[model samples]
Target chain A: MRVPEVLLDVRDLRICYETSRGCVKAVDGVSLEVYAGETFCLVGETGCGKSTLALAIPRLLPPNARILSGSILFKGVDLLRVSDSKLQELRGKEIAMIFQNPMTSLNPVHRVGFQVAEVPVTHFKMSWREALATAVRQLGRVGIADPDLRSRDYPHTFSGGMKQRSMIAMMTTCKPSLLIADEPTTALDVTIQAQILKLLHELKNEYGLTLLLITHNFGIVAEVCDRVGVMYAGKIVEVADVTEVFEAPLHPYTKGLIDCVVARRKSKSRLNQIPGTPPSLLNPPTGCRFHPRCAYVTHECVKEEPRLIEVRKNHLVACHNYEKVGGVSWSS
Target chain B: MELLVVEDLRKYFEFKKGLFARKQYVRAVDGVSFSVERGTTLGVVGESGSGKTTLGLTILRLIEPTSGRILFNGSDVTRLSKEELKHFRRSTGIVFQDPYSSLNPRMRVKEILERPLKIHSDEGEESRVERIIKTLEEVGLSAEHLMRYPHELSGGQQQRVAIARAIILKPLLVVLDEPTSSLDVSVQAQILNLLLDLQSRHELTYVFITHDLLTAKHVSDFIMVMYLGKVVEYSTVREVFSNPRHPYTASLLSSIPIPDPKLRGRKRVSVVGEPPSPLNPPKGCRYHPRCPYAIDTCELREPELLEHDKKHFVACHRAGELSFREFLADMDSFLSE
Candidate 1:
């Protein structure tokens, strides 16, 4: 099978928030790429800058957050340098994002159909009637039965799963080249979460859309992602194939995250838990953000930050002792 | 031996719709019954609005049960008077889902920990502080943390402080309402491990209420699956996981995503449609609307929870007839389509 072409490219992105407690380095020097039809996942714990990195792609960061450096290239156009009018034109047409909480993202007073069709009408200059028709079809595509009737109902009328499905329908109604889904299934139950993930995978294939899936659940990343990027303290520490990351995680943070998840198949004597909390973003540890909690921390790990170095064919790890870190090998 | 026995427990909240209109009864805990043995964890798993939290609260008599018997130590605490209930509350403590909200923001960790000890025991203030410090250590918090308020700590640290306060009273039964749900995965493991250690050390009984099956399976000796205010299935963790008798139980287990991508295409039972409202539940079985094998009998009469094995009890009319493997295979095809 031929690989899809790259659609969006992010280079050395840096984002900082001006808060009372000092400038919070939210997304610090992060870079990633999204292929035309591939699912590239950003996996990390909360406050690891996965969401910040995602929001930066569409230039949707709050007023307090400013992009200190870097370029976001979509079809060779730097999104960071684009004017507000141009960025607005590119938002729902070239890129769309699905937020974590669907309830809050949706307008409470407006009908579901109106909220969904707002983008198509505003961006594409389509008639209200024509946009509503398209929105109905989009709802049906996301597996909501009786879309025509349900579209007229309010957000409160729908259940959690239905709300999430409606959110997906609204996000993908324009058929943007890249879809950034930020923890879309975290608020849902296991069964509903499974259905949503399956739906997302189906939608990705049917629309031939590239995806940037953000989640804290490793299980979700393993299931949906083709390539995975593990972030820590606003930096991509490890990037590799899904199978490689799961089978042989290189970074200490990634390893600890994998260990923390309770696998359905693994029957262990005791669950392995990583000790200590993630460092604060305001004053993140000097050299390596993960050095404080890393089990194999060396003197060099504290003095200088490690860069992403190719360890194997397609695996990149940012650890000083990638060659010597012991335990379960990733070759299996 | 049964340390606490709940027989046909029910809690209903009556809402006055209008001045002269009829009232509406919200059946939060509808005729649920289960027993907890000494030194064991009974995990109650369900989705939101499934009455798992209300059941936990009702057992402790924090909220009075509409109708039922909560027999602890062979004494029916459900029927106890307000003053008498205080004695029962002393033996039972609750840790809520959100530690930040549950703990008072204004109070320091030391005050929160000492309140329970001061209320339940007649110990002097100086000795109580020492005991509070010891409890903090047990939950993996330090005495330095005692002076800090809930806002000063992270989510995990606040949860640890909550655990210290709950276990400081040495309650025989502790109702943990999603104790580790709000914390991060790594911190969740630490909290769960602490709970396990404390349970074994004190020989305490725990009613762990959560929607997370993996965590439930990790800590619980026995697992109970609830749907629309009903206990659909209750069994040993190993037996329930390996060979789920009830269709609902089987579907819940299969729905959980395993970390391995190779198993992504594995067969799983997927229950379609949302659970019916508790205000007007289904006629016979609450799960019949979502069950794959719902038949005429299932709609006509509710199946009583019967023991298929030594300790496994399932409440499905077609439990013996339905094959979980075949159902899962069918669901996989249906879902993929």
Candidate 2:
């Protein structure tokens, strides 16, 4: 019944990557808000700029990626306008990120304990011994059995699930108020995936930490996320409560994506597939980026881009014909 | 008549230590047994290191098995001579998960498809070229793609080319190892539908290996759930999904995040921890360490795979102790949330 406090506000974010094939508009004119203590999910298929937007928040873009225009406001301060020194102070302290590939993100040459310890060691300027001790404790919290001994092992020796736990432990070393986990469980097995999801859910509630999860798996979205944002062609096409999105998807892209998964499926016939592959961000379609594959495309939809408008209470969609295309009735 | 049958196949790799140190053996595919009749698919589903991929490779004899027999059309492949093996392999094809890596970048799509024909068939230049063109068309690719290298094609197109290469030989059995995992869902749907159509038309038996339970259920006539190199449960797609007998299979099924938001709050058994180290898989039942319903006897003795229902086999010590309905109900409860 009440609007939650916005912890991170991304307004008019536009990011482009300088590639030899020309500039790619990776994150184009995106605006979003993450409220405090809510596990928000940004779900999309590959190459939809979900990762790009996540990296933009911490100004962790690669060398070729440039923030064309945007402001990432975190707790009333523009993360983009902040000085490098200020960002350094904020990163891994007030906000932490857990990447999809922990093996690459972690320093392989070092022990898992030492790598996780690096977070606290550098941020708090704690002694190596003190940090290592804290790392063991954090690893234990994330359910790494025998954390005391396992912490001494190399990350390469750890399984995918263990490596993920170590990454989660490392990310939370500073006890950040917000955590951004990007496809953390995508590479894991279903059983191991369930464990990781449970751990993440437990950690989110225990620490009262706001989470920004990026994944393409609708199952993971329903399992852990509270609010969901559907992404297509570097644009947010729909945003709603997780229940609202799955129960009644307003955007055609959102409807098509949910229809493709087998779990929530109703028909035994061929899946309701979206007609074409995702549009190339290098030269995206005019007006609505999803119009090329949209089932309810129209003259108005092709001429002008639509903005997020609330058709139902707290449910926002960016499609011109939400009423016509939102006829996606789920058995649930 | 069975198209392919694997009898208790075991493939192990020995890691040599120092002269004084003992050798360590990794049983990548241990005591796995299954069979598929003509025009049917046997889906092998498992998590990483569960040997699902290794099992696929072993069936194709890409890797030598440590023991057991691979019977193809009632003939033992393990006993085949090198020359006989070469000829025998012509009827079997395998499509890997990463299409980009599997396809040769140096060769054009034409050469890739032609090489198979050159090795297996004695068809002359004209017919070979014609076959190559036809194969490309069969996979929904036009002749225009013949000259292009793998790098020139998109992921979906490259995968189509890989599929084309696999079926170009007109193999009796095609092993699809996580074929659609790397592609997007829309592309995945197309590839799956194509595979299904091809299977029915060509009467090809498939060994579909993947970690996705949903896809396994959809594309398979029968399903085999493997964990740590051993089969935990094997049954018809409907039975395995609806009435899973093994705790591991039940846990695996429940773990798949049902895509409905309303089901989010539903009860689901959350497997507590990861599988133990393969080298030290728990003493008795491999799944006992993580099984929520694990009992004391489970830790002392392993459960043999038994027929719990018609054609449904499960390996769980408590299979008789606990009804699958109750086990499934308990599995549906979320431990953390």
TM-score of chain A of each: 0.95, 0.96
- Kindly report which residue stretches of model 1 are placed more than 4 angstroms away from their true locations once superposed: A1-4, A264-269, A326-332, B325-337
Residues A27-125, model 2: lDDT tens digits: 998999999999999999899999999998998999999999989999999999999999999999999999888778888899999888988888999
- Fraction of native Cα contacts reproduced by each candidate: 0.48, 0.55
Best by TM-score: 1
lDDT of 1 by residue, B150-195 (tens): 9999999999888887778788999999998888878887788788
Q: Lowest summed-lDDT stretch of 10 residues in model 2 chain B?
A: B328-337
lDDT, each prediction: 0.85, 0.86
> In angstroms, how far off is A70's CA in candidate 1?
0.8
How high is the DockQ of candidate 1?
0.47
Chain A TM-score for candidate 1 is 0.95
| CA shift of B32, model 1, Å | 0.8
Q: Specify the poorest-scoring 10-residue window by lDDT in model 1 chain B.
A: B328-337
Considering every candidate listed, which one attains the maximal lDDT? 2
